[model samples]
Target chain A: MLTSATILSALLGGLLIGSAAGLLLLLSGRIAGVSGMAAAALRIADKGPPWSQAAAFTIGLPIGAAVVLAIVGRPEVTITSSVPLLVAGGLLVGFGTRLGNGCTSGHGVCGLARLSPRSLAATAAFMGAGIATVFVARHILGAG
Target chain B: MRHALPGLVVGTLFGAGLALSGMTNPARVLGFLDIGGRWDPTLAFVLAAALVPSALAYLLVRRMERPVMAEEFCIPQNRTVEARLLAGGALFGIGWGLVGLCPGPALAGLAFGVWQSWAFVAAMVAGMWLQRLYADLRDHRPVHFTG
Candidate 1:
């Protein structure tokens, strides 16, 4: 089912992500880590340009998606999990990202680009965990 | 002031990228994660494509003395491969596998106005707050040792 169109779109999308991250770093000298930025925006103790910048970036996420919807049409999303499950998952993601100090964007995309050993280790750990969880959820638990 | 515009622009582009890459779709993301099942390698392509530009960007950064808009680069300084990193990454991976939604894609998906996205964001924020509280409590706890 992996068609050429799918490959092209994925590549194009990734290029955009990389460009955006690069732009942020080149212009503002900041890592394009979504969780870190979101947390910084919410943290009351943090002040000034960094806070405002983070808030702006957080606000822009939805706006960009809106633009994509207008231009390219909305992507189909179906959540089969119950609300409770969803909440639990969300909580873990939020907590883990903060505790780990990065996520896919920070560690996977940007960190890998820089060839940082820590990021490499984090990426491998998360990928392994993710794969194992998916196997258990889909195969063993039958909770697709 | 200057930082705001660039931040917004970068965020917008990043969100757009996520949407275009099919990351906004939970099913597709789950498919990518499901290695034993009907695994999808589209995300791998995305990662590879993203690396090209980002790698070049780092090279560009190496040439610059400072960011055009900031006084100094605010890169992460910690290089330790601590237990926290591994544990937190594992936890995050499990959550991501369960929901197929990470922070960036979750935030970008908010444009759909789905209750799931809203709920996830709310829960994520609360979790972050809770972690901060725990960290604070740990810092303030009195050390007791038995001689």
Candidate 2:
């Protein structure tokens, strides 16, 4: 249940994330919102995204993680959620992120940073719902 | 190549950050959401810390004539908090609470070789496709994603 809050590591990691986001914004003039990128991945000409940068950024996420896994250690990813649950969750996440027009990265991080009201509203709604869902699952449903 | 290079570098840095911050760990994310239980404040720190640089970057955007690589900073102009936004956010939260993996972490989690990661990502993509199809039907046109 309760674990030690690694504040320093989170802070450092967040700074790196923020820097990366900032770099993207400055260099490529794009918000580093993963959901948006993934949702529109196959829609080659429908949208106005620069496909080259989007493709490279999408490809690099796993590469960076693999490097960390090799050099340091794998991030503790002991997921016990059933395949059914995972699928349901993924479907909801995918549909919802697209519907809302952003996810944690887009709304929670990038949106908040830019002081966008819509992002703020979306983030608040998600955070509130996320907390409520966890409570229901853990306390009521007896699920993880 | 220049365009691709910057994106690759940025994505790498972002992936490392997600891993190093323990965002890649579903447990850590769930723990943060475990407010009535054993709550963790690590996510808060990460969100707060992340805002600093991006906030500055946005401010800088105001002053710059144009971005280095792009013709213009490609930010969408959706200001209102519409019903779709709230409903979609709530739905996403439910899924996130169930799995503790969002898009960013899910993509990055591919490196961890977890079955859950694969299942989640595949289903997520399918869901996105479903949503796009639904949107197209609603508008009677293939909607251009401005996300």
Candidate 3:
């Protein structure tokens, strides 16, 4: 259903996301990438603002969702994959984001905004890979 | 504490955006990915909306001497495209397609208290730890001596 409300929600949501990233950079000198921040939250050895700040940001992710839920009610979320599939996907995401140095937010959002060639390449690769995976899973494998 | 306060605010906003944009919904995300099917272009709009302000933010950052809260910006310095980048991206994409959930949404979904989100988060953390371990081992590998 491609309604005006959907479009408005997406646009507003995107603005909020961009504003958060922008503010993070302007205020804290950090890229608002979830994977990196989450990893930093687990870094026991690293000290200083980076560690505590990362931990705080990570904690806030869920809180932000909670706030949205409080206002707009719970979102409709469907989990179709089995436990094994979910676990495998999660592991890959975690490992790949770390190895690749960023995920959608870091590479797709901030990196593209910066006009970094590496980010462009990474984004292309991931998007291409995502399209191929979907094709295989849905068309070829008949999973979807 | 001051530094962390900013992080918390940013994170909250980010999460709220994810939920509001419907990124937290796996079905919606899959709709976006399903170009061959009934595709949903909502995610693209979200991306565009996000890029506009973020691009502007970078422009603003260029004029500033330093962040308001930090001494210096900790931006990524690496420029070269390496094998790791391509491989990792490919792997990440595959995972994203399978589940339609990325790190941000996965964490945000935790607020719903669903078992699947919890499982995914736990596995994700394990995967990160595994990567660190692998990197450590590779870096510390003993050099071989040729006869």
Q: lDDT by residue for model 1 over B1-147, one digit each (tens)?
A: 888989999999999999888888888888899999999998898889988888898899899999999998887767899999998899889888889899999999999888899998888887777666666678895432211
Candidate 2 lDDT, B80-121, residue by residue in tens: 989999999999999999999999989989989887899999
Q: For model 1 chain A, where is the 10-residue window of minimal lDDT?
A: A43-52
Task: Give per-model TM-scores.
Answer: 0.95, 0.94, 0.95
Q: Model 3: which residue pairs collide?
A: none
> Which tens-of-lDDT digit does each residue in A29-67 have in candidate 2?
888988887755555225545677777887788887887
Q: What TM-score number comes out for model 3?
A: 0.95
Score candidate 2 by lDDT: 0.85
How far off is residue A11 in model 3, in Å? 0.6
**TM-score winner, 2 or 3:** 3
C-alpha DockQ of every model: 0.59, 0.66, 0.58
Q: Write down the worst ten-residue block by lDDT for model 3 chain B.
A: B138-147
lDDT values, one for every candidate: 0.86, 0.85, 0.85
Which candidate wins on DockQ?
Answer: 2
Candidate 1 lDDT, A1-144, residue by residue in tens: 688987888899999999999999899988888888888778622322387788899888888888889999987777776788789889888888877878999998899999988899889988888899999998998878
Could you tell me the TM-score of candidate 2? 0.94
Cα error of candidate 3 at position A46, Å: 6.2
